[model samples]
Target: MSGARYWRHQDQRYNMAGNECGVCGSRFFPGKTMCPNCHRRSVGKMKKFYFNGNGKIITYTIIHEGSLQYRNQVPYLLAIIELEEGDKVLGQIVDCEASDLAMGKKVEMVFRKLGEQGKSGTIQYGYKFILK
Candidate 1:
């Protein structure tokens, strides 16, 4: 990502800030301009919401291979987390061992460096989760 774009989305990357539909109360991560559920009623009525960053692992995989940007993080855990608010998000699992994780294991989000954009470029920050 470019430096400008990376900084622009800091709230979302770090705080799980998305949008909630004022009409149907539906929530979305990477918040949409309109609610999928409420459609027309939700347009121009979406409100910002910050997630509490607590969730449970729905499923996960140990990635032993990755692109150059994530090469050092090979063998790391990638998971689908079901947030307490009912939104499922994908994030890296850090500070825990693969042997210690299981389906439905509790996890909480934490801010971490995603990667650098390029040589001497901005250091991207984002959320990852850890076993609770």
Candidate 2:
């Protein structure tokens, strides 16, 4: 994660989406290198965009056995959120109890420190789901 593609994914503000197929006017998230429907490799970067980062809880799970970085954060949530635009993504739900969460619950995105800053000592910032 030290090259062009690495830096590209590091842009957290950019909605984890932005792929376009030149062969078709289709757009995709996680930036597809090729079109899944048309099977064309003529893909290019689409305009960068951001979502409110707020969405509805569609599903979730609790992780017990995890990395040392998140082991203490146990009983943590890994949830599927459905954005306003219908795009769904998995994220960690913070600041609330699992009992307090449910399907169709509203969640707001907040920048959260993901792990021990990878030698930088500064934690990497990313999105988290909070009960709204």
Candidate 3:
């Protein structure tokens, strides 16, 4: 990714920063300019929200074939996590084996190196989940 683009999303990638609707009390990841539920009422009522990163795995799958950027990390576990505050997010489950995971398992966010732009490009960092 370009430096500008990567830097632009630094907050959300590094901190799980999202947005909450002041009008209807709805929260979103990657933040939103307006709340879908409250619509017009949420036009200027969206506020920044920082997730606590505590959640549970609602479902999961083991990846034996990954994309070009993540091929080296194949055989990893990915899951749909239901955050404690109620937002569901997709994240890679690290530091554990597939045999160790199951639905409804507890997890917590951990900061780690996600990937790089290329061999000589930017080293991207982001959040990944680990068993609690």
Candidate 4:
């Protein structure tokens, strides 16, 4: 059986996210149904692409309150990363000291299991960032 089109479009290899526009030759991350520039819903998707997984921190915060899974991972880093592809994404940071957090700092992504999808479902694994 075929999976959801969005699931197939995301590059599991690198956690790259992009959506193409039918009205304009533009792309966006964190996939959506409509184009922001032209306000059109007829978006086009080309072949899947992998991101470089290296970005600079745009903005971030240390999370103290979160889900059960993140309870012990408090003071965790969640940041808006500006990718090399020119897309900004929100994701977690790992494998580095919290003191290293800084705007415009270089980061590299590491794929890790986010958590179980509710219960008795998929174990979602995605990319996370670490100081470079």
Question: What's the TM-score of every candidate structure?
Answer: 0.85, 0.70, 0.85, 0.72
Query: Which stretches of candidate 1 lie above 4 Å from their native place?
Result: 1-14
TM-score of 4: 0.72
lDDT of 2 by residue, 1-132 (tens): 443344446655664444555665565444557667776345453433356566899999988877777787886889998876435778899998889988999998776667655555554556687898
Which residue pairs in candidate 4 have backbone atoms (N, alpha carbon, C) closer than 3 angstroms, thus clashing?
Answer: none
lDDT of 3 by residue, 13-113 (tens): 35778888998888887689988888898998999888888899999999999888679999889999998886788999999999999999999987777
Clashing pairs in 2: none
Note the clash tally of each candidate.
Answer: 0, 0, 0, 0
lDDT of each: 0.85, 0.69, 0.85, 0.72
Candidate 1 lDDT over residue span 37-129, tens digit each: 888888899999888888999999999998787898888999999988758899999998899999999999887778877676787777899
Cα RMSD for predicted model 4: 4.4
Cα lDDT, model 1, residue 7:
73
Instruction: State which candidate has the highest TM-score.
Output: 1
Per-residue error at 69 for model 3, in Å? 1.8
TM-score of 2: 0.70
- Model 4 stretches with alpha carbons more than 4 Å out: 1-11, 45-48, 117-122
lDDT (Cα, tens digit) per residue for candidate 4, span 1-132? 223344545555545656556666455665557667767445453324456678899998988897787876887889999987656889899877768899999998777767666554556667788898
Model 3 weakest lDDT span, ten residues long: 4-13
Per-model root-mean-square deviation over C-alphas: 3.2, 4.7, 3.4, 4.4
